[model samples]
Target: MDFENFLKKLKEKDRVTLSKVITLVDNETKEGVEFLKKFYKERKDSFRIGITGPPGVGKSTLLNKLIERFAKKYDSVSVVAVDPSSPFTGGAILGDRLRMENIYKFDNVYMRSVASRGSLGGLSSSTENILQVLEIFGTDVIFVETVGVGQSELDVMEITDLVIVTLVPESGDSIQAMKAGIMEIGDIFVINKSDREDAYRVSEYVKSILQMKYQDKELTPPVINVSAKNDTNIDELVSRIENLKEIFIQKGIIERKREIRRKKEVREILRDMFIKSIDRELKIIENKNDKDVSPYEISEKILKNIDFKSLEDIWKER
Candidate 1:
């Protein structure tokens, strides 16, 4: 369908329309880009949770568990699961939600699987756009589950009100999570697969590290052990997550973090605009026989009036 019709229907609170619009956004077409612009204009704070860890850390299972528990409390929830993108096909595999069978059918649950597109940032531009779209729809909680962890998951770290780093006892994440940067990424931590041995050890390890690191800070991250497959401690986990949400608000850091995220979003938008203008300049050069200037030539001309050699510096960096 046309963009106008899609927008009209999506704005009317129809799930089917929003689902179609989400597919469009997933494709990242020109219409999809426009839809995102309209989508973000209505954006507000949605309860965003990032569940991330290395592969096979029970992220999907934990996500499914959280969906069941959270859906009971929230009126509506949106989930964005990031999967590996095909290097050749230029699309995401979208496999992260294959295990989230039950939540997909709930009218209150909307989940979309996104391909990572090999972006080092962990989140593609479209992933960020989709999260904002969920917020626009007024979802009570928006969960973003990343396939792998590390610095890339840090992208979600900036945007979410709470970050849950999920891991099993034997995965060595107990040690990995203590890395200075990793510890800072989570507001709360989850030791999934709690039925396994050393789950409490992992929890104790996290706590000891938190005490050492935050010797002066007011709040330290909380760790919970839960078995996603067996549904053990799921309700308590949900309640703890809800509690952290208020702690974040009380500290006033969440709003500050979001302000920085907004700044980065604006910078990306401006960068995209400038890149498109350069592409347009190149196209004009390609079509014209003699007089039209290449993007480099146009850049030189634009920079000539300024004495700082801006284009020259940019070229040097490239």
Candidate 2:
């Protein structure tokens, strides 16, 4: 279908059209790039919340509960759940949707499962672009659920407005090891499965760490204990999220985050374009079979020949 017709159907809330648009954007097709160029300018604002933690931390369960609560209050809510991709097949099971089966009943809720595609940062390369499409589709709130991440995998912080680090009682020691990494990125800490033994102890441990880390700062990350399986304390969690959103807006933190996101996105786009241009040059050099010159020398030749001015003109045309 043409872009105009697809957009018209999107405004009419066609799920099929929405799914197709997301696929196009995720694949980064020529049409998808054109669609985003137009839609991004006309996109509405949506508060993006990122939930990230280690494997088997009940992140999906907590997210399901949060989505249920938000769907009641917002006109539209969406989810981007990233699952680990298989190295051999380049495919994902996308099992997060199975765990969040209940959310399927809500007509105002849209959920898409994405493969991490071997990304070390726990996010797909196209994640930010897919988010832009979701915003253009008129969601009020968007939840980004990352694949089980290690300490160094923190790409979520670059794109999200708020980051919630979910933990279980068993995460106490892990938190100590990750204090400088994932722990520092959280705006809120959640201890899921609070019905288990030592849940409060873990929560207090997390609180103490936050206190020491943010002692001089005006705002400290709040730690909450909840049993997502039992639906306990979900209301409090939602309330805290709402309050934090207000606080972030008042402090201009969200706008600053968006500014940084824009700059990073521009750099990534330029880098990708440069890599493609270099590959084109390399192909021509390969056909010539210059066995006498080393790889480094060929790279220097390509670098020297590159017209930086033309790159700026190309960006302007885009």
Top of the candidates by lDDT? 2
* Model 2, CA-based lDDT: 0.86
Q: lDDT per prediction?
A: 0.74, 0.86
- For candidate 1, write residues 1-318 as lDDT tens digits: 476676666667678888777766666666667777655667668888888877888888888888887787788888888776667777655776678975866778888777778575377767777777677677889998885455566787876777888767985564664466666777777888989988898788877877876754546777888998999998888888877788778888778878888898889866765564455445645665756547577668644554334434543343
lDDT of the structure predicted as candidate 1: 0.74
By TM-score, the best candidate is 2
Per-candidate TM-score against the hidden true structure: 0.81, 0.92
Q: Which segments of candidate 2 are over 4 A away from where they belong?
A: 148-152, 216-218, 285-295, 307-318
- Superposed model 1: Cα runs more than 4 Å off: 1-8, 38-41, 88-91, 173-178, 216-218, 278-318
Model 2 weakest 10-residue run by lDDT: 309-318
